[model samples]
Target: MASSAELHQRRSAAVARGVSSMIPSYVSTAGGGTMTDVDGREWIDFAAGIAVTNVGNAAPRVVEAVQAQVERFTHTCFMIAPYEQYVAVCEELAALTPGDFDKRSALFSSGAEAVENAVKIARHATGRPAVVVFDHAYHGRTNLTMALTAKVMPYKQGFGPFAGEIYRVAMSYPLRDGRSGAAAAAYAIGQIEKTVGAVNVAAVLIEPIQGEGGFVVPAEGFLPAIAAWSRAAGAVFIADEIQTGFCRTGEWFASTHEGIEPDLITTAKGIAGGLPLAAVTGRAEIMDSVHPGGLGGTYGGNPIACAAALATIETMRELDLAAAARHIESVARPRLEALAAKHPAIGEVRGRGAMLALEVVIPGEDTAAGPAPDAVLTAAVAKAAHELGLLLLTCGTYGNVIRLLPPLIISDDELDRGLSLLEQAFASSL
Candidate 1:
């Protein structure tokens, strides 16, 4: 097999410059919480393909399902010939997503597509134009999602002239904002009423736990408050659970943690055991408002992907991965907290279940002068971890947060070793 170096040269020649990889080593095989590179080196995986492979890479059931599906059929285009697997997947989504009322689902190819369709459905249902998002939120890379996104660098740098009527408000970032959940919600609601006017608002879109925007867990009561306001204003409340769904946050969905039921929820990443499948699931009435033929794509709900999703969901239920995620939190969070106590650079350690993060910052003395984001230190720590054969990923609007998204199925030994390597990385970097 060609080495990673040789492959890198070819990739540099062929792939677009805009596309980037977290690590240089190319994978030969991956499973559970570890990945083997072409050079025969093994690395403990802490980033599950940006939270995609929650059931682990190449899970047995998912593999068997995909194989069986490939032998039977690949694609007839659900819009053209339709398929049982597609409908089955949708049915599963309706049953799984957060709502007791009659729910409906529409599948798509990627998270971005799911988000776009959610917004489209919200606008159509509410008959309004303005969609409200929050600060430090990341929806996706598409045109409309870029408008919905808050960060400018990398995701929306020069891709300007974005879609219109997307308004942004302050998010309940506890560490930085220092506002209680109720206070923050009131502030955001005030901004919407003052600037966008509740009458013109179509949707209030937000991530339950902001993913790429630093895994900023909104303070308690924040999500419920926003959902209440959206309901009172006759707006569709959308929870972008693309990164935090599928038991990644210790629940089937993060919104459930706060007892908030969004009118619409966009899910992807962990939904299909790494296969590209996304969905917009919501109340039946709202989803049906878009009329027939308005919310589908050519490759949406591919049979192989649907099969993978079915197997993925089954594995999650059978294994009780939601509890597995909570167990991971129990094992990892204390270690992370201990590390923070030892290193001042770790300004804060936050997140839930397997989705955790360390916000790197330049230490400060007084409360008035809050900690400053230390992106340089964050990058150095990640690089050192990579050299130690531990995979890591960094995120945040300021690019100073090290987010840990280990597979829910990671073994205890593997998880401990990964955390040890991370400790060593921080020590050497400091």
Candidate 2:
């Protein structure tokens, strides 16, 4: 096997510079929370391919299903030559997604496409022009989604002129705003009502638990209140569950935790056990509102990806990964909380189930005034972890959060080892 250094040297000459890699090494194989690089170095994976491998890397059932699918066929876009796997996957989505009402789903190749279509459906159904988004929200990188996302650098930077009529509102960030859930909701509601009139709004889109934006879990009552407001205003309530869906947050979807059934839910990351598959599941009426030809891409809902999705869903249910996510939280939260207590640089430990994060900040800041973000220190800690062979990720609008997205199937011993390495990283970086 080629050393990572040699591979990287070759890659620099071949791969596009704009395409960035978090880990410098090339992976040779991975399964169940661990990966081996081309150089034969082993790593305890906590990123889970950015939460896409909730069923674990190359899960047996998923591998078998994909192999069978490959033997049968690969492509045959659902739009042209429809397949049973596509229909079956949609049926499973309807059954699994939140909301007791009749739900319909549209399969796509990525989260951005799901989100973009959800917005289109919302706009078409409501006959409205404006869409509302919250601060620190990350929808996607597509032109329309870039307009919806809050971050400026990398995602949105140099990518304009973006889609218009998108309005930004306040998010119920408990750590930053120091407001109660209801108060935060009220504040956001006030902003929407004033900036984008309720009569003209098509959708109120938000991540039930923000991803990439620091795993900022809003306070209790925030999401429900927002959903109620959207309903009363006749706007679609869209939950961008692309990152928090599946069993990542100990629930089929994070909106269920708040008991909020969004009119539209966009899902992707963990849906297909790491295969490229995404979906928009919503109330049948709103979903069907779009014209038959209005929503679909040539490669949308490819048969092989659909097959993988079915197997992934089966694996999630068969293994009860939601309970596993809760178990991960039970084991990891206290350790992270203790780490926070010991390290002054660690401002807060937040998030749910297996989707958790530690917000790194300047030490000794006034508690009432909000600690300042320390992105440099956060990067240093991440670098230290990487050197120690722990694959972790950093996120946040301010880039000061160490987010952990360990696979639900990871062993407790691996979690402990990762945590120990993380602690050492923090200590050494500080």
Please give the CA lDDT of all the candidate structures.
Answer: 0.95, 0.93
| lDDT by residue (tens digit), candidate 1, 251-288 | 99999999988999999999999999999999999999
lDDT of 2 by residue, 1-430 (tens): 7889999999999999989988899999999888999988889899999999999988998999999999999888787888899899989988988889999999899999999999999999999999999999999999999999999998988989999999999999988899999999999999999988999999999999999888999999999999999999999999999999999999989999989898999999999988999999999999999888889998788887888899999999999999999999999999999999998889999999899999999976655537889999999999999999999999999999999999999999999999999989999998
> What are the clashing pairs of model 1?
none
Q: CA lDDT of 78 in candidate 1?
A: 90
Model 2: which ten-residue window has the lowest total lDDT? 363-372
